[model samples]
Target chain A: MSKTIYIAGLGLIGGSLALAIRKAHPTYRILGYNRPEKSQQIARERGMVNDLTDDFASFAPLADIIILAVPIKQTILFLKELAQLDLKKGVIITDVGSTKQEIVAVAEVCFANREIDFIGGHPMAGSHKSGAIAADVSLFENAYYIFTPTQFTQERALTSLKDLFKGTGARYIEVAADEHDRVTSQISHFPHILATSLMLQTGDYAESHEHTKYFTAGGFRDMTRIAESEPDLWTSILLSNSRAVLDRIEEFKERLDEVAQLIFQKNEPAIWKFFNQGRAMRQAMEIHKKGGVDSFYDLFVEVPDEEDVVLKILELLRGISLVNLHINEENREDSHGVLQLTFKNAQDLATAEVIIKNNTDYHITIT
Target chain B: MSKTIYIAGLGLIGGSLALAIRKAHPTYRILGYNRPEKSQQIARERGMVNDLTDDFASFAPLADIIILAVPIKQTILFLKELAQLDLKKGVIITDVGSTKQEIVAVAEVCFANREIDFIGGHPMAGSHKSGAIAADVSLFENAYYIFTPTQFTQERALTSLKDLFKGTGARYIEVAADEHDRVTSQISHFPHILATSLMLQTGDYAESHEHTKYFTAGGFRDMTRIAESEPDLWTSILLSNSRAVLDRIEEFKERLDEVAQLIFQKNEPAIWKFFNQGRAMRQAMEIHKKGGVDSFYDLFVEVPDEEDVVLKILELLRGISLVNLHINEENREDSHGVLQLTFKNAQDLATAEVIIKNNTDYHITIT
Candidate 1:
């Protein structure tokens, strides 16, 4: 019989991974160890795994691989508990937590000479939305999966963990656990902290300016919208990765100060050069392998009120033979509407215009 | 015959306005004065206006409105030209620039006659792309259009200009040009400068780090994507709006310093509170009107390659239909590709899932 894979904490990351592994390796028996009854049911119903239960011990010894996908605090607690468990000598253990240095330190300090082997993993797949409700089997598809293999990390366990993610359509990158935390702190965590801080300052002044209500247009919303992320999760990440976060924060300060000084000196040429360099650099950076950066353009749409106008337009464009068309009604507002049409070439836009104008009386324009 | 409207520069903002004004006010004859011969041809071919010409003199005397949408430096130059021309008395003159204080100052210093009324106008509408090719009339449909009226401004001229923008489906706001510059420097101009500078720094670092290829995700992309905007234009804005931009840069520095101080002190509680405050304020803030703030979820789409697959899914979804659909053959990458489907609610999601799984062999998932 194939080994059973046990996923502790059946939330977005865990549940989604369960589903992804099941599809990729159908012969493997997947078990979910969920604390909440609702989470277990959600996991089972979503076809995340073959079985679900709360008894960790009964399955702990039987599991070939165990994935810990929980908060940083909870991860430490779970590691503490798992360290004392009677496990098979070669059992592989891994986690999907944002911060790794602290967790790796805890593992080394507490689980010395443990039968089970641990490897730190962080798949750079995230969304502002959380919980099992947001879980989808394909979340990790095409995303970069980082493996932080510490000096204490067992080689075989790391290989097994990488193989598991490889089956899920994820690309792998390896780094030191401490280095992982530091990199994310500079690139990810620090940006979140800076965004939140900017938001706080904007809020302090927002109360006094009513015109700011109208002024916070597309650019402002895009720049500051990340500020609305869950505070608890960010707080946890910041505390765990304080050193890295502070380092990036200081770096950002220096960059900002240079701009201030240039502006203060009234060096128009220097300021212009500064602005030009940034624009060129931003334009030149190659896109990452995963989903491109989140922009305000992704979040803003105007929805127009109408029930049948959409269907009428679709019928009008039936002759064009489009591969796909997407519309979202939940986020649609009362006065504006967004229609995203995919075309094989620029010629299709012309066909779309005629169809939209001919079938629907509402004004339809190409984006 | 209705009054003629003369637009300078014939770029995105100026050309789009000409197109929208012609559509909304059919009686109005629109004429474009583009510097480049190519721009005039493109604008005429795009039907952005009824007439496109290089002769500013031909239309200058007969115009009821003159919109100067050129670069700020050119704007001052154009003002000098308009100041010398035999222009109609009480003919309303307005501009569509990001910064207002500097332009307002120029108007006060140069055009002191008060005979040629200059109501400093700024329509807060922009796109990541640029030039006449990317111009669209609907870009400013729901955008905020502000008029910075100084002490010498006439009441009737201000009212007339407001009516003109109302015709273009824009809401008008009033503010002192200096105040407008200050507020925008904080919200709009400063963000642009910061985004560009950060991107430049990252780009500089990318040259050394092998992992630079993987860092462009989430907030980094969104924060820096705007940095990919037009360089010469941004450089001009920074030089023109130096004081206000510097003030904002200082404000951000102070905020960064406060966060850094707490980090050094290990004050987790204070840092957490600061993040929470930002989250709360961003959540409570309105989506439109003030600072380009908007809701975050409306921006992106997850699409697949097959047409029948998407249509089958849409067919299953009750009451939810597509507004437009096109198949882009040139843009296709994978064989069993994703299709973009937009739906109204949970029922639509459920119905679509059933159809997708039942009809197509490809796996279907909602983002």
Candidate 2:
């Protein structure tokens, strides 16, 4: 049996999802909807759409699964329009919105007493680059694809949706809609707002002072880099999750006060404990991006100002393939350097560790 | 006519400064003082000290300049001790403390109406490594070295201190002590506190929630990386600049509240304007600061994900040196991996570029 899946938006997220779905289920017809005259032929010619139509109300009824991958406001509008349209029985409808509470609420009301299953999704992956031209199959690869499944959502619909998105190679996680909204608010929405605020405050200070511009370090840069992201996009994200974002700010202010009070009282040990906890947590999550400590082994070797030390290490491990090695030139001296070695697998890492230990008397630390 | 300059505390910063100063002014007799035991013999054998002494008071009378390269607490203690029995005429004293206000205040009271001249200094750079052996001359190179000068600071003394530190290759910026503390509290001290707080809050959130561990992204990582810094050093810094830090937090809360209110009221255009202003300011200042960066040569090579490929490049560049090399782990699976090589100067990069091109059939780009 073949299925017709109508994807509403063909921008980066939607088009990428369309490609991933089409690739996963070759028999499923991916119906791409647009204004018909707006790049309709070009999108189909590029093979992103198996079938193209301008009439979503006419095409939505045929879609077994409907994906609303537009911006939040547009997605809400589409959900209302989708609610009014005649839809297929046992259809699974999902939207890839950053915040899920509003979308899930709208979805639940719209799909109530109907045969349709509404499951909210948030593919927690993004790029500064946007639009139809930026779509790619591997955009969601290795990323976390969250599904906010409410009590109204049918179990079988989620399974089918999961099967459909298997080609995306994203790790699937299921949670309540409110839980999803809260987490997104803490990690994404609140951080975005704080980054922007911090940047604005720092900028104002810099403008008023002479040569405060010279005091920036890599930390300042890292803290404020997200402030340069798309303003309109962030505004939508923050507003969509306004309640939770506001809660986060309130909680953050409390936490900030706790730390500031400690600083003001000169409670040195308490300050240390706070940062130490932060360090411990950050360290525990350091190898997370590379899929845990067992997967990627990092070996750091301090090499005294001597020629051919790094070359010798390379020679010893010539037969065994390693991941990466670097000398941080920014802090490196003309005579002294540190060799940072990384290995992909445990076996290779063990072999490299043994070889290095046996061959060199240099101080080595592994993390 | 070699003048004796006394250096106290030989840690990473102190040792590095000693190495740099000795390299620049070889004729200057660097008197190293300890109880004339411990690592005194080892440090002298390593050439970090020339003339050894058991008493700083005895050593103080013979020196033309004194450097307190110790921690903030230790530096302050030494400043008070030095004030009691300092006899050298026109002797300039300086310190390498992260926070300057407290140290300057102590020195102001200690050396008031005396022939001693004290100018506060802070080299805004650091590494995890500590102790005498961990020092590297290039640690301060390209880093910002700030001078906090006051009305009591003699112009000639300032010039002499600047001349001495000319070997560090750091960009010198002069500002008042209070101004220094204010700016540093905003950029360094406040951000450190906030990052640690953010991490702790997120960690608490993660602890309470199930499967929230998978929700982290690059932004989260960037915001929390500074939290991994040494807790004790940050504790001292925060306390030393507590007044300014508290003021900063007050100002930051106002800014954060402004953004939060805009978000809470769902003022779309106003929210957009806030972020837009942030983006513009961040962009403008990013360019303003980075405009001073020296040109570094970059070379990119596309390598297949085969065994021993990176090794081959390393082996080829064994004789030919490189400044930095990185395998962009993000897009490594884009059929082939690209190796990014950076060089401080053109000659080494040119040699490596030629060698890699001639040896491999992979696509190479030089920038």
Task: Choose the strongest candidate by DockQ.
Answer: 2
Our model 2 lands, by Cα RMSD against the true structure, at 5.3
The local lDDT score (0 to 100) that residue B30 gets in candidate 2 is: 86
Q: What's the CA error at residue B33 for candidate 1, in Å?
A: 2.3
Off by over 4 Å in 2: A33-47, A52-58, A132-136, A284-367, B33-46, B51-58, B287-323, B326-340, B344-367
Q: Write the per-residue lDDT of candidate 2 for residues B57-162, one digit (tens) a residue.
A: 7787878889988778888888988988846988999999989999999999999999899999998877655666566666677678889989888999989888
Flag clash pairs in model 2.
Answer: none
Worst 10 residues of 1 chain B by lDDT: B292-301
Provide the lDDT at B308 for model 1: 48
DockQ each candidate and list the results.
Answer: 0.29, 0.46
lDDT of 1 by residue, B12-85 (tens): 78877877777777888887888766667778877877776676666777678889888888888877777778
Model 2 per-residue lDDT at B131? 61
TM-score of chain B of 2: 0.81
